[model samples]
Target: MVTLEQVKHQCRIDHNDEDTLLLGYVAAARDHVQRYLDRTIYDVAVPSEDPDGVLDNASIDQATLMLVGHWYAHRESVSETSMNEVPMGVTSLLAPYRHIGI
Candidate 1:
């Protein structure tokens, strides 16, 4: 997870402004999602139980699906507020994969 201090330091250099909690939160959120996808999708492991339930326990397809669902559920509110704007880059990256319905 990206720490507040790390985010603040980067933000200060990027935005040339003082560190703010909100900025740190945004950065951390993005970092968290990216890291989650990277680890879950790239690293695969066998399911301890119900092997049949998970076709490929090691792949991250399920986790990605879940994350996508969660994002879609919150898209409306996230799109509405300027302060909470989803990072454009991240949103763009996930756009093509957005399922039509939850």
Candidate 2:
């Protein structure tokens, strides 16, 4: 996986700096959403008769947007300033889902 900083570096000399970085971040965040859902729903919710249906209603894309919205909304509230903060936010956002256990 490519780091956000590395992507930003690649896009630094481009004409659209902020947009490029933002797009990369969005893609990375959405990928995180997919991986998180896959892990929490399939791998973690094991031994169940119907795990797929359990997560069928999950909308990773929408959830990713919400996560990004919340990040921008409360950027100041999050004490951590590093890139790890995004994944940390993702974990917190998905905490409620983890307890579902299919």
Candidate 3:
């Protein structure tokens, strides 16, 4: 998905204190997006990794970043701010990559 630096840049953080935490969020976000699309997204980190069932596209990457930003901002399940629109955007980004029943 996204790198820790990318996540930090997205979240506008200027510190390295939370690199591990941010990396964790990145992994979780990547997995979540992959699951939502019902397929594996390509992993650039592992160049030797299998390419089968993998999607290497910008939308999926952006969606993953969006999710990480959202999760990073809102750590808790519940928040005072309404987040009903975030998922819609993520879905739209992942829609093309999403597998539908035939």
Among these predictions, the greatest lDDT belongs to: 3
Report the error of model 2 at residue 42, Å. 16
Model 1 CA lDDT for position 8: 42
- Which 10 consecutive positions of candidate 2 have the poorest summed lDDT? 52-61
TM-score of 1: 0.24
Question: What residue runs in model 3 are displaced by over 4 Å at the alpha carbon?
Answer: 44-52, 86-88
Question: Between 1 and 2, whose TM-score is larger?
Answer: 2
Off by over 4 Å in 1: 13-20, 27-88, 96-102
What TM-scores do the predictions have? Answer: 0.24, 0.36, 0.82
| TM-score of predicted structure 2 | 0.36
Q: Using lDDT as the measure, what is the rank order of every candidate, best first?
A: 3, 2, 1
Greater lDDT among 1 and 3 belongs to 3
Tens digits of lDDT, candidate 3, 1-102: 567778898899999998898899988988888788777676554244543356567787788788888888889999886556855588998887776657
Please say which candidate is ahead in lDDT: 2 or 3: 3
lDDT of 1 by residue, 1-102 (tens): 333444444334455344464444444455454453332211244355623222222122333333333443454544554554345444454444333433
The 0-to-1 C-alpha lDDT of every candidate, in the order given, reads: 0.39, 0.50, 0.77
